[model samples]
Target: MSVSARDALRMAALYVVLSMLWLVVAGRVLDHLFDGSVAMAVGSHLSSLIWVLASAVLIFITRARLLSFIGLGTRRRKQDSERLRMAEAVFDTTLEGVLVTDRTGLIVHVNRAFMRITGYQQDEVLGQRPSKFKSGHHGPEFYRQIYTSLAQTGEWSGEIWNRRKRGEIYPQWQTIRAIRDDQGEVSHYVAVFSDISAIKHSEQELAYLAHHDPLTGLPNRLLFNDRVEQALGTAQSHKRGCALLLMDLDHFQSINDGLGHTLGDQLLKRVAERLSHWLGAGVTLARLGGDEFGVLLERCPHVGEAASLARDVIEHMKEPFSFEGHRLFISVSIGISLFPSDALTGEQLLRNADSALFKAKANGRADYALYTEELTAHAQHRVETAGELRRALEQNELRVYFQPVHDLTSGVMVGVESLVRWEHPERGLVPPGDFIPIAERTGLIGEIDLWVLRQACSQMMRWQAQGRSLAFVAVNISSRLFSQRGLYLEVAQVLAETGMNPALLEVEVTESAVMDDPEVSLEQLHRLRELGLRLAIDDFGTGYSSLLRLKRLPVQKLKIDQGFVAGLPDDDDDIAIVRVIIALARSMGMQVHAEGIEQAEQADFLLQQGCQLGQGYRFGRPMPADALKWG
Candidate 1:
């Protein structure tokens, strides 16, 4: 309604009201003036005067009601002007596209926000329906569902895609409320919409960051769990088996500790790259955190194929990487769990695969193990045994065993290998293999190694006290212990404390440990040798080593790997390698011993090859010190 038109109506109403009030006042005053007691001439004059006054009063009251309703008064006009201004500001400044429709759903009112949001001008949208902005982005069923909901509830809020002025379709959050008539009928709809495309983009970005490994940009533990659940469902539908393979980089912590986290992170990226490159389209590869990765092979045909793929992955990781000016070598221990074969649920599969991984590391690092019921049992037993071992070590239940290493050239005894023997009160003797690796991983190897050194020397001294021929006492150095900074110093201290001759104390180290960093190993060996002690390369053929480098070390002896000697006579490769190693040792002016000798032929062959030392089950298995009893 226009202000001019409203004012005209107010003026007309005021004129009518004033005219009525004038008539009422005039009627009453005329009655009073015409009273009988008054003279006719005087009453006539008074009646005329009263008639004028009543006419004036009627004009004033009628004018007041009309003017007030039309905002003619100062206070009313100011308030009305302020309200109109506030309404105009809201229509112009609100972010949502708002439109007020008439009873027939025709757009009667539109705001600037509507024009901006719908890509239409005031002329285009003023007479048109809100459906003008529909982009056909929604299906018929989708539209039907939304309309049905809106009709039933009289209010609807949802996401809708609408076309813009440039014909571009964009998603928006829309709220539609039914504008009701005074008679309670839904006369029209007031729709308010906001563009949510940016919000959607932000949500996607947040999801990616949350569920992926930042270092490798690969799916992390969160996403891995989702994939596992998906793979399980697929497997059930297809009646096929899925494999969950858990792989951990062996000795990754050592690499990080020795080099730095920067190098470690770089290595992880390289590993992730290789894994992603090798993974097939159907396989899901994700980092489970740190050095751990998970692979879900959905619809795998056979368990063997999963194992083969795992092996391939391990082989790929075995390749050397140049990280931070150092040739970094990494190996993976993979554990495989098959659906229906190992477990049923996602959690079960992951747990079983993890347990298998434990076995893989236990059997040795750089290997793979398949999940089985027996493996699960072994894992549980191990946990129990670890607890027992902890208590046993604390209670002085662990004792040292001595396996005599005899001189091959003569029928004389030489050094005895010191082996740890655990005697559980109820379970009797437990083998070293059952607990050694666990101890190493649990950070108990240092103490165990020290105890072995001290006990070995003490016993060797006891033998000397018995007037028996006291020979060199050999103690195996685990990789964990060998990697320590002051290993040689610790050994020298142990020997001095035991009052054992340094010449009779031999520290045996595996070839892998020494070859890990030859320069450092050589320095440590030299330090030990300078202490009047001996350094022997233990399990000689079990690791990668260069003869050229070995010659520079302070190594005085080579112990042929039990693997090579055990299969000798029948396995030509084993025999040939053993013979060549013995010849190499002889040429280097070092003694050679054939370990794991189990047969007469093997022992005789090793002796014929100029190997002067033999330590094996054929001679005597590792036995408790009390069990040795001068045998």
Candidate 2:
């Protein structure tokens, strides 16, 4: 019961006692003073009634005031209870862990989330300091900084590594705030935090993926370039030499085509692993793309060190790799460029290394080449020439020249091979060797091949109109064009437009081209054969051709590469190779043609060896159709 109710009851009891005494005394006095008087008795009765009415009114007013005070007190208690429930709900249900501490930093209270996140019970950490959950990842200075900030600003928030109850370390985002009393004095501290381990892990994964190759788990081009820039800076500062090596796997495309991409990817991973194993400290190896890898050698002592490393890389790569029971042999060509010697900037270093790699590939596979100033000049020239070649095609500055092939037995011009010559207005005449490679590299070879095919066909028809009876007109096709999907359609269209017989048109592809992807090459060759055009393998002996695969090819002829022919009968190896090729062609019932016959002895030797066809400078150099001399 309320104090007000108790006081009201006491006052009422006092009034009741007084009223009883007064009633008794007044009744006696009235009886004694007005004895035997009827009027006096009546006056006494009226005075007693008036006193009773006043006492009843005073009691009613006090009771009403006490009831109003009691009701107001009850409503205030109900409101306080509701507010307590709301505070409890918020404290327990919030996702963020809440911990309250006294001014001395001892934990006083913790919410359900705090218990769940730290794996600690409320009883276990009730009076413990926040240091009890320290992961030791942050030093004393780190905590001092936080405390200093908190002291100055009354609050602090940041990422912190904390230890859970199970002794595992995790990251959390935490905010600590100081609670002050009404007098502006600090009395308590509250901390709210959330586990951010998962977010940190995701960020790390994203960062790693950005800089690494997904297939090989090797650093990618972006990372490689950044590392190169750093390495260059270090080299420049320390006055030390550094080397950049760019590597390309030789015949990797053939392996990819033959064995399938999955196996190819596995091969690349193995290759990366081997290269990484061979690298010493301070060396970084990365995959630039598709069978291409980059190596940065920091603090290299000299060029000889770079060369030695390159040689070691080549030798290691030469070792055969066995994957899924298939023994595969791989080789890499390396191009080395030095910092502050060959080039300075990261971009130039990479470019020069790539240029050297191209030279290494051209010299022959399985070798290494150092970047030279000459290579840069050549590369720049090729870039300029590629642009000119593109314009040449658009402006009709290209001309078709014919080189006649003679039947060795009859000594008669049988067929003519069509070759393109660029009549550069300023350079006079640019050889095909000068610009054809550039065209191929720039992806302009297909367009050039198409143009050559159409012009060659048109020229053959013009020669026929002039009463020249040529056996056939052969045109060289780029490897890219041979694999193109629309090659058949393009050839068909050219033939229809030129009104030439497909039987008299022969398309020549290198042995490397057909063997690159024999299945696809077979399919494409079959499509071409279906058009009634003859197909031949050019530079036959220069590539690795399996006789079994060669037998399966849809070709009618194999032209001996000029290299083997140049060293004729006196060169025993050349003689043996040529004899074997001719014998192989005869056994397969395919025609054999010998190229690069510069002397009468070479021709006589070829004829004696049973080679039926020959073409070289001896018969005639490539010339315009109007300048051709028929013999």
Candidate 3:
């Protein structure tokens, strides 16, 4: 398919003829209409017509100069000196480099752009073979392919690497063509190329961004999984062992909330750097989304090696990270799964490691746990149970049971605690302990608490219509629900919808809920108190509540935790704690309420210890609203 000499000359003649005809016809027509000003305007930088004009001029110059530079331009003449000047300027100032060689592949003619791009002078490249520009990046086969394509197709265009005069290799997008004469014989070779180094650099940067996290410059989840798959393959092939460790920064959300997100992002970068520093050779570390990091040990020979590494990571994270003159303390929890034992596939391995990580966090943060069958079973159960609980709520299978809160001295039921019970069709009545924890963990407790609150308000209105002597009905609010900003608004709406008095509604929040964020919790509590509702801190001694914060709470009642009340009369330690709580409640002008008074002796001791209100199985177990009785 090599272009013949006659055809090449014919095409070149046609291009020049068309360009000259356009210039003559349009330039004369516009000159007659606009007094030649338009013609001059179209010939300058503001004109889009310069590209076609310049291309036609370049082809004419290449043919004439190409023959003259190789000593075969006997018929070439300077009939148009002005046009030649314009063509020469185009050849000199064009951005793309142009080179012309004889049929022998000797360099005969080069434009100014060729010298600028190749960093060579005209005298340096003249009379030399084009092969002198070879960069040594491509082998003999690469050049052979180029020659083969050019010989068969008459032209070749592709990306190539070439050397500059300064010996620096750079990429170029080049096109080379064989020029032929009227006798159908090859006369010279012409090449056009542009330095594409910037484009190549941009592509490399884009590829790196695709696989690495921009914030921390660590491998992202996509790359992390790929590395995990590779490690697993290597381990399987060599019959070695691999371990996948997933680490999470405990209480990271608190830090992010207290400080700004800018500092939080910087903290994450520092954490990634720390983890990378502590990682040993052959370990692949990655950032698996927010506040989570994954590590792969491809050569974990012993099972204890994974444990030791997890311990090291946790201990290193225990050291405070300093940023902007602030020392921020954080802890890490790690979960590990071994290859060929815990899981065979990467997906299963990550899932199992995450389950173990849940166990580590549950056991109290700053710890590590290994994968086990029980962990998988527990994870499956949680998933299945959460789904079932969602269906049960939608089907209205949830029922509220009431437990009486009795006055200790008079043994009169003053209030009822509304506790939720899931009446499963297949499992009968599911206990609160069985499903309540699941609800809390899955974040369904917020919805369930709101539903129970609405149900309790409606039931309270019914009880009031029945002339019951109960002063108030208490409903337990999970910490997840109690911390919500809209809790007060929801309660207000429920009261308005049910026509129930807010004064008779006692919302019981756990001590941990109030202590979670004292300032925010205080604001929420004050909002609820403004609605004329009673607030009580339940499970009082189980959390770390400072006396200073406790004094600022707008609550009127303290329900002592059942764990402290379980050993009331016999255990001296329980006896002292019960007395102190009663005194603490009285000193704050708050009513004292004790939970889990199962024994008569415990009730008598609590009453003697100045605990006014108490609730337990001894008085009456949790039952339906209609079944509740006071004696």
TM-score for each model: 0.60, 0.75, 0.76
For all candidates in order, the CA lDDT equals 0.84, 0.91, 0.89
Model 3, stretches more than 4 Å misplaced?
Answer: 1-133, 148-155, 164-166, 176-199, 462-471, 481-504, 524-532
* Tens digit per residue, CA lDDT, model 2, 397-480: 999999989999998999999999999999989988898878876889999899989999998898889888998999999987
TM match of model 3 to true structure: 0.76
lDDT by residue (tens digit), candidate 3, 451-566:
99999999999878877768899999987787667889999999999999999999999997787668878988999999999999999999898999999999999999999989
Q: List per-candidate RMSD values in Å.
A: 9.5, 6.5, 15.5
Winning candidate number (TM-score): 3
| Tens-digit lDDT string for candidate 1 (563-630) | 99878888989978988899899999998977898887888888888989898888888886666635
lDDT of prediction 1: 0.84
Worst 10 residues of 3 by lDDT: 70-79
What does the lDDT come to for candidate 3?
0.89
- In terms of lDDT, the best-performing candidate is 2
